[model samples]
Target: MKLAVIGAGAVGSSVVELASDHGHSVTAFADSSSAVIDSAGVDTAAVLDRKRTDGVVGGGAPEDALSAEYDVLVEATPTTLGDAEPGFGHIQAALERDRHAVLANKGPVAERYADVRALERESEGSVLFEATVGGAMPILSTIDDFDPSHITAVRGVLNGTANFILSRMATEGLDYEHVLAEAQDLGVAEADPTFDVDGTDAALKGVIIANVLSDDETEYTLDDAEVTGIQEISGSALELARADGRTVRLIAEVVEGSVRVGPRLVPDNAPLAVSGTRNIAQLETEHAGQLNISGRGAGGPETASAVLADIGRL
Candidate 1:
């Protein structure tokens, strides 16, 4: 497939490298850093180095790059749901041109899932976003297999950074700040880290999952959901978990019409107890019972693998 990658950050760069490795022709790479985008098809290693040096990151504007025709357009930019002009505009342009879209970015889908779905219907094109939720894990596809009416409840540790921090707090007795710094050093947390540390990241994932689990394509809102960041928790919470043979994890759940995202003390025997850095998600349904998925939650190679899988579907 001829593809266009609309970001050159960690995920986008990984997509470009993986697609190119799979023998797919990467038509254009759009990023603020012209040097990085230009070097996408040439020297990926150097492009990564330049990105590190320049810090000109996030999803690149797709205005100019989308003008060129391509079979598929992959959106891997950093998410900001409220404003979709540049990002959503690029996806719309691809669909308008009858090109398939594979999105790894959550912003467009989280804020405008209904509109984007309608656009896909009108354009007769597909928008696959397996990487958006669980990195390479196939949570979305599993939900797609069953009838929405059969789904009873959805719950899991949706944010890996929070999970990792909690896990470290339990194991090493480290405070939130220390574990967060460790996560950043390990590349699990972004430099800003607000989305992961706070519950916003998990809340967005809940919105997407709720949409998939709902019978109707009703617009899901994050307003009613209770969200709390792991930062609010003290190291003493981890100590309490140890006293009770438990560990704290940032859990998110969508049951009926209500959704909740917050840090919870999970029993030692719980599946969440086994979840490590960037891993874990579970879906419970009337028919399917309980299905669990766990893997590297955030990483270039894992996310890139998902983009490649979507490209294969095209």
Candidate 2:
């Protein structure tokens, strides 16, 4: 597959590495201020090195990438609310060209599902975004196997950063701030932890899942989901829950029309009790009963693995 990549962040650099590993070529890529679009092949290593040393991906502008020829456009830009723009526009440009889109960006999928589906309906290209929700875990694809009517409920430990903090507070009796700092130092959480800790990330994933299941009938957006994060969860609170063999986890759920994310208590030994940066997603189907998948949910390389899978499937 020939890919035009956007972002050039951890997810983008990892995509460059795994694309080579999977025998694909990245024809174009863009960072914040610059871009490089080539028909033959973009120098993946050079782009990555430039991003590392100079803080820019290439010499050209992002518009150059949008116009480049490629089999697929891999959109992995940072998440945003409202129109989900830049990423949304990038994907739209690709669809207009009849190029397939393998997305790692959550904004376009979560905030503008109806518009996205409309583009793919008339265009020659199709869109797939498995990496946006579960990293490499295939949560979106697995849920697609069953009929939406049969799939009654969906739930998961969706945010690894929040889960890590909550897990540490429960096990080590450490306060929220302390563990969050530790997570930041270890690169488990971003320097600005607002999105992960404040439930926006998980809620965005929930909206995506709901849209996928309903086929955009719900028109679910970021505002539709009810969100609550683990930011205020303290060590003392976990201590009280620990006395009852319970732990707090930032759980995301979609059942009926409700999409929700917040702290939930479950047994410490439960499958949902996964620790560290691991994640688990569950699907409830009337015929299939319940199916679960658990694995590492974060990290650039792991997510890029998922992006490669989507590109191959396309």
Instruction: List per-prediction Cα lDDT, in the order shown.
Output: 0.77, 0.89
The segments of candidate 2 whose C-alpha lies over 4 angstroms from its true place after superposition are none
Tell me the lDDT of model 1 at 38: 37
- State the displacement of the C-alpha of residue 82, model 2, in Å, after optimal TM-score superposition: 0.7
lDDT tens readout by residue for model 1, 1-314: 77777877778888877776887867666775442233234355544565678764323444556775468888877777675556787789889988999988887777787788888888967888888887888788777776667777778887778888888878888888888888899887779999888898898888878877763457675655689988888888779878999888888888886778988888988887755676678878787579888887777788888888878867
Best by TM-score: 2
Cα misplacement distance, residue 176 of candidate 1 (Å): 1.4
> lDDT per residue, candidate 2, 70-136, as tens digits?
9999998998889999899999999999999988999999999999999999899999999999788
Give the Å error, residue 164, model 1: 1.1
Every model's Cα RMSD, please?
A: 3.2, 1.2
Prediction 2 TM-score vs. true = 0.97
Count of backbone collisions within predicted model 2: 0
